[model samples]
Target: MTALRIALLGAESTGKSTLAQALHETLPVLTGLRVARVDEYLREWCDREGRTPRADEQRAIVEEQERRADALAVGHDVLIADTTGLMPALYSEYLFADTSLAAPAHHAHRRYHLSLLMATDLPWVADGMRDGPHAQAPVDRLLRRWLREGGHAFVVVQGQGPQRLEQALNAITPLLKDRAAALPPTSPSTVGKPASGGLFSRLLDRQARLPGSTRWTCELCDDPACEHALKSALPPATPRVP
Candidate 1:
C-alpha cells in the first residue's frame, strides 16, 4: 500500500520541527501503523556547509528535500514530512525573486495526502539558518498565494506547545480514517493521483479527463474559486445512531 503522506508548511519559527517530532513519536501509538518522519534536508545542509544556499543552489536543495521524503514514504504506513520542496521554492522566490520553481514544487506538493500549514502565532526565535522575524509575514503571504494558485488545500494549525500539537492531531485523525477507508489502491496506472474522498473526490470529478494523464490537470477549468465554492456547499454530515 502507498504511504499516507502528510506535509507540514509554514514560515520561520512556526513549530514545524517540534510538531513533526511530536507526531513522529505519537502517530504509531495512536494508529498502530508504522510511521516515518523526514527531517528538512536544508537544515542539515546548512549545518554542514556553515551557510545558507544561494539562488543557483536552491533547486538542488529542493530536489534533495523531496527525494528524501519520497524515499522514506516507501514501506511506511504514514510519512510526516517536517518540510516540503515548496519551502526552498518559496525561499528562492522571496529571497531571490525567482519564480521558476513554482510549477515543479507544486507538482511535488500534490503528492501529499494532506498539508498542515503552521500558523505564525508563536514568537519567532533566531537560529543559524533563520532569516529574521521580519521575514515571516511576507513569506507566509507568498506561501499562501502559491498554494492558492496551485489549487492545493491546506489546514492552518494554530496555538502553542501542547495546544498546537492537539490541533494538529485533531486535523490528522480524520484523514487517517479516510485514507484507510476511501483512498484508491496505488498501481502503475493510478500512481501520482490524489487520494479520493470528500473534497478530493469532488475536485477529481470536476477535472476533465485527459488522455494518458497520470496526474490531475486543470486545463479545462478556469475558475480559481471553484474549490472554495465546493467546500462551502458541502453539507455537514449527520451523526450515526449507535
Candidate 2:
C-alpha cells in the first residue's frame, strides 16, 4: 500500500498537539498504521541548536519532518504529522509586510494528503512557554483562508475529548481506506491498459463528455442561457405607462 501522510495544522492553543497525540494512540488500533509527530523532530532540532527557534527555523524543522515522515511512511502505511505554528495567516503576514521570510520548506498545503484543522472555540490554556493572550479571531481567519486554498481538511471543535477523537477517526478512516484501495497493484502484467483500445480513445471519450461543449449540455437546466446568463440581470421589466 502507498504511504498516507496526514498533517495536523491550526493555530496555537487549539489543541493541535493534544489531538495529534490522541490520534496517534487511537489510529493504530483502528487502522494498524504507525503514527509520528513532527514535534518530536522539532524538539530534537531545538536541542541541537541549543536555542529557542524562530519562525525561520520552522522552515528547516518542517523540511526535516517531511524527510523523516517520507522515509518512515515507506515502512508504515500511514504517518500523521503534527505541524508547527505556521499557518496561512503567518504566510499572508509575511507577504503583506514584504518580509524576506520564505515559506516553510514542507508546506502543509503541498505535503499532506489530509490536514486536520483544530477550531478555536475552546478556551485558551497557555502553558508556560505559550504566554500570549488567546488569538481566536486571527486563528479562525487563518483557518478559513487555509481551507479556501484547496486543502483537504476538517475543523474539529471543542467537545468531550473522547468524542472529538472518535469524530476525527471517522472523518479520516474513509479517506485513508479509499486512497489505499485506489493505489495500483504492483504487477508488471497490469502495468498498461489492454491493447483493444488506445489512449486516444480514452482522451476522445473524456473530451466528448466535457461540459460547455457542443457534445455535452448542462445537466440541470434545459436552456443554455439558464446556465450562462448573469445572475444580476432579471427578466426585462414591463415599461411603466405615463
Best by TM-score: 1
Our tally of clashes for model 2 stands at 0
If scored against the real structure, what TM-score would every candidate get? 0.75, 0.60
Please write out the lDDT profile of model 1 over residues 1-242, one tens digit for every residue. 77888889988999999999999997765555568999998889899999999899999999999999989998777899999999999999999999898789999988887777776768889986898988887888787677668777666666668766655665576566665454345533234544444323432332223123222222311232332343322211111111
Error of 1 at 239 (Å): 20
How many residue pairs in model 1 have overlapping backbones?
0
CA lDDT, every prediction? Answer: 0.72, 0.49
TM-score of 1: 0.75
Tell me how far candidate 1 lies from the true structure as C-alpha RMSD in angstroms: 11.4
| Cα lDDT for residue 206, candidate 1 | 27
Report the number of the highest-lDDT candidate: 1
